[model samples]
Target: MRIPSYEDMLAAHERIKPHIRRTPVRTSDYLNDLAGCDLYFKCENFQEPGAFKVRGAANAVFGLDDEQARKGVATHSSGNHASCLSFAAMRRGIPCNVVMPRTAPQAKKDTVARYGGRITECDPSTSSREAAFAKVQAETGGDFVHPYNDPRVIAGQGTCSREFMEQTDGLDMVVAPIGGGGMISGTCLTLSTLAPETKVIAAEPEQADDAYRSFKAGHIIADDAPKTIADGLLVPLKELTWHFVSNHVSEIYTASEQEIIDAMKLSWKHLRIVIEPSCAVPLAVILKNPDAFAGKRVGVVITGGNVDLDKLPWMQT
Candidate 1:
């Protein structure tokens, strides 16, 4: 669990330039007026493979040599990371083995399959997924690309901040959702080094608040069952991420399920983007607490767009 440095992130941008998309930062006058702030959305949902996970996955896979790439790669992901890794593996002309929960969305699974990667379903528990992934690594001799805990992965994630900063001006705060903490950890590191005055805030779901709890407790907290519609945020925080977050982040806030659903619906109806629950978490925070960010320039990292189209979480039946 090593945190990536700003220099490492800059290098990662160079390494992954040809592979990952430098997605646009979009602004909405409607959202800005409602929140009382000038808001810029880093639309990673429009990113290649439809998520920011591609930045890390592509960097990790491409960083490997010909022989290492030939050995293939393995990881456990319930959603976006799997698709990104599959796409990365395809780029290298090697096989990608992804271990996912049996209950993962059909859309995500189909996307991974379309990218020419092999999928193995396992129980959703951390231990089970790890055991399954280890078996695949042993059997196929593939490199293990962790979803959010690796330094190279963190470095790749930091590039999002680089792109966001370049596309917008005068951001006072950048709010990003936290899961295993890869995105925020990398984002905070970049802001701390490049824009020290801009505070980084983490948006967590009330149902799965490991990062928030850990932030309040002043140490790494674990052993809590995650129960949230933001499935991507269910993973426990890693040591590297916890350290970076505690030192660099200004605060962490939690949003309820209904709040997330409202935000998701609003984004689709008003913003006209199909944002998943995890992607809606940051917007939920702003919607829930308007006083804090009112009249300030803020950046929201809209994480990904992968979702179950047949059964959307917020659409009333």
Candidate 2:
């Protein structure tokens, strides 16, 4: 797995510029006062396909040669990646085969279908998704577009940070949630190149802190059946992403499920954006450890906004 250089990632930014949305950098005095720091939010929820995954997907799909594009693409995604890839494939007039777990939320499955991607339901376990994706690749001869492990995907994701850095200055730190570590890895890499003085932090749910543990232990750590409201962050980091995180990330922080729920509600109320639990990780971390970020100018990436409206965790009571 060859990691793309900072220059290569910037080139991908140019290639996908027309296809992706330049999500806004929003500031909230309320959050700043609460955390005792100036905060800039990168609202990727307003992005095309409702997540930062679209940037990577679009870059991967369009980067394919004619022969590979004709073969189409396959992947296994929990939600955001599936919809983003499906949307990108649809735009490219290519067939997209997504191997999603049967336990995936109805809204996510519906979103994929809406984008014309064919879904293959499998067990929600990592092993099952991997097996099913391999089968799809063998059967359809489709190029496998990994959710976080692909270099092209990482390069595309890095563009988000590039855009954010170009739009804002004087960020003491950049915080993003870590799942399979794609977004954090890409974000950290871009910051390492573009804003070396700015610290990059990986935020994860305490229940799903594989990245945190792995970074501490200096090896890849796999959680055998993790459970968390941050569904997009259940997966453990893979090799390519681990390398980037270990090298560029300044620290890893964990947030409780309740903290994520609170952050989600706060984002909806204050930012007027409906962010899912996973998207709230950065806020959760900030609220949980205010001292770490106090007196610093921070940038938090609100990664996505997709959620089951009828079953929002806060509405259950």
**Which model scores highest in lDDT?**
2
The alpha-carbon deviation from the true structure for residue 41 of candidate 2, after best TM-score superposition, in angstroms, is 0.6
Task: Give the per-residue lDDT digits (tens) of candidate 2, residues 1-317.
Answer: 89878987887898888888999998888888988998899999997688999988988999999999998999999988999999999999999999998877788889999999999999878988898888888999888899999999999999999888878865889999999988987887688888899999989999989899999999999985688888899888998998998889989999998898998888898888888889898999998998999899899998998888878988763
| Candidate lDDT (C-alpha), each | 0.88, 0.90
RMSD (Cα, Å) of model 1? 1.3
Worst 10 residues of 1 by lDDT: 220-229
Candidate 2 wrongly placed segments (more than 4 Å): none
Clashing pairs in 1: 36-295
- Could you give candidate 1's per-residue lDDT for residues 229-316 as a string of tens digits? 8888878888888878889999899999998998888888877887788999998999788998988889999999999998788664
Which pairs in model 2 have colliding backbones? Answer: none
